[model samples]
Target chain A: MDLVERIRSGNKRTLSKLITEVEYDTETGREALRELYKYTGNAHVVGITGSPGVGKSTLVARIVKELRKREISVGVVAVDPSSPFTGGAILGDRIRMQELACDPEVFIRSVSSSAGTVGRTTKNIIRVLDAAGKDVIVIETIGAGQVDLDVLNVADTKVIVLMPESGDEIQMIKAGLLEIGDVYVINKADLENAARTKSQLSLAIKERDGWIPEIVMTIATSGEGVEKLVDAIFAHKKHLEDSSNLRKGRLEAVKSEVVEILVEKLKMRFYEKFSNARYSDIFEQVLDKELDPFTAAELIEKEEGL
Target chain B: MKKGKNIRVLIAKPGLDGHDRGAKVLARACRDAGMEVIYTGIRQSPEQIVETALQEDVDVIGLSILSGAHMSIIPRILELLNESGIGDIPVIVGGIIPPDDVEELKRRGVKAIFGPGSSVNEIVEFIKSIT
Candidate 1:
């Protein structure tokens, strides 16, 4: 009857409303998140990250189909970058995943990477989906660049999707994607030189936690080799569980989440405190060369006990 | 405790209409207006549209149909939205539609209809007002 009850009962509208509340970071949303926390940690959160045009969305769609075939309920959180100037975005990932959109068991939410707080919001969204009882929640990151490794902390199974002939072996290693992936998905493997890419990836990927990352070749368009990718995901999940590494990974995730929250709160507090007329004296001092910026910052911190 | 929320709108082209120039223009306008626009490219079924609206939890739905199938396609989209329990989210159509059918579509619960030559600013302002 209540919000949590309705969400648990799989009321799509209520679930959607809750997600909106969460996105807005409202008081009710925070309350619901706290309430939902007890029911979280059930879904296997999968992060699908790759460069633009690497078929991350299509691969996610295919992966969800494969998951649904096994009667697993899915939640997809597709992230797209917001326009930095206008604070808007065109979340077009659903164009590829429309077939599964109508599925009663699958829920897809597009997230705009707004305000640089995408990592935190995504964590909460996954919590909502997990509490709602989705068996697997896939998070497709924004067309990522090298060093955009935020997905590393949010996902339990990190799936780095790449394409054949995308780059040479050294270029792939320089991208640092080889380090974070639990499973490597070379989507569009039907293209030329896939074998070379696979071998190249195999050489660069080092064994971590006694579980070597699996490279699964996939042509996500035709759903070729997706089942193997799914199998690889599950195998990695099993490896984590049997090795008791899942608990360890969750500990790291929680630690990062807490730190992220703290950093955001501190940033807001700092802005609220310093962005005022009262701080003009300090700014003037720094600008007039009567005080250095670092000393001025320390003075403010000491005076405000910040 | 935050109150500000991003307006999320789904702009889609339904039926056999491959002409998406208008739709793309509208989507760009909405985005520039600071609304997150989910643009599902041309030729989407009513089911796909409604399903996307529900999944994305969009504040509004804008249909761009140039195929003159508003009578059939729009109603089906509304019906599917109702069936999906998200009929409350407003649906607006923008494309080639006769003036006579505009009132008819409105009578059938379409929030608004924008025919050809409709200014992008007008449509954007209308969406901003409604959402």
Candidate 2:
């Protein structure tokens, strides 16, 4: 409760703890979110993503630092998904942004997509944090050079980062990177083929339709050319809002999320009850093809009414 | 003797290295041991791993780090759990741990380190002993 209150009052420690608890979906976490939900919607959510080696972490840290310089309070959410058999997180991108955790005006949260759903639960809890009162939110998805397009679905503004010459237009097309970028950043600007990479991305962008996403060139590690990237983020966020289509999309998404949460809860409860109950005889009867999945579902729903 | 309740385990793989064959296999083994095992799909963060272990009310946070970044990642997760008051969760380490770092993780409060070639029965037995 103290953490919830303090987070609402913009306390970094409280916000950090609350983010962890809520991301974990603890009872207190849910309650804290419920209390703070009304305070969300104030923070702008900016999602930073791209292929694995595009230096998304370094890029995100730079962006957060830049935003902080503007006196804007920011919350960072980073997702890491490297294998741990070696006994460590492979990406460790969150560590790049770890310094911001100590800042009172900045709250940073790292989520492993492994522990969370395609970020739906993470987003819910984070939206709760934002409502509790942060000025901006940035989410870094796990992995590099994604083909899944999962992060684009999660972000208010999608910044797809690419390392110049990391790959060609064909590679970007193969990874489906061409479609997800609301803003394309050719990072590693200090590299040898920065210009060539930009041209290839330009070709990729031209080949795509609709919004004609902007492409920015950056050298994220040294903080070179990141301000333009942040400006592009804000602009894109504004563009999405001004379009008014975003509101409708958001409403639909919220409704879908609520439906999904309830369905999952009921499904889990049904599974638990079915697994533990003395309905084995009935199940066996059905197993003989006497009852179908629909009837079974109906019976379970009728019996539980949850 | 078996502990007060089932030994809960959270099996997680964090970061971009998405080879999950080992993680899935280990998850199944832990469950077969009669431990309540929660498998966080693939590519998790130290924070997500720590948070899930807390909420799942798990007894052991078994991390399977295949990527080479284990040195930097495992310590941060331990720190987060400690910060959250559940530092006593009796963390376990698994997957390609270099033999040299095995003792180091244990010293950092990791109770056990199970790597490639480790047996499920042995892991179960180890968990039983700890619990």
lDDT of 1 by residue, A1-306 (tens): 988888898888888888888887878889999999999998998899989999998999999999999999999999988887888899989889888877999999998888766777788888899989999999999866522477446788999898999888668678377788999989899899999999998988999999899999999999999999999999998998999999988898789778978987888987887777778898999999999999998998898876
Name the weakest run of 10 consecutive residues (lDDT summed) in model 1 chain A.
Answer: A143-152
Per-residue accuracy of model 1 over B19-125 as CA lDDT, tens digit each: 99988888888899989999889889888888788778899999998897889999899888888888889989998889889998999899999887789999999
Please give the CA lDDT of all the candidate structures.
0.88, 0.70
Docking class of 1: medium
lDDT of 2 by residue, A61-103 (tens): 8998999999988767666662323211322454466455446
Against the native chain B, each candidate's TM-score is 0.95, 0.89
TM-score, chain A, per candidate? Answer: 0.94, 0.82
lDDT assessment of candidate 1: 0.88
TM-score of each: 0.94, 0.64
Among all candidates shown, the one with the greatest TM-score: 1
Q: Which candidate tops lDDT? A: 1
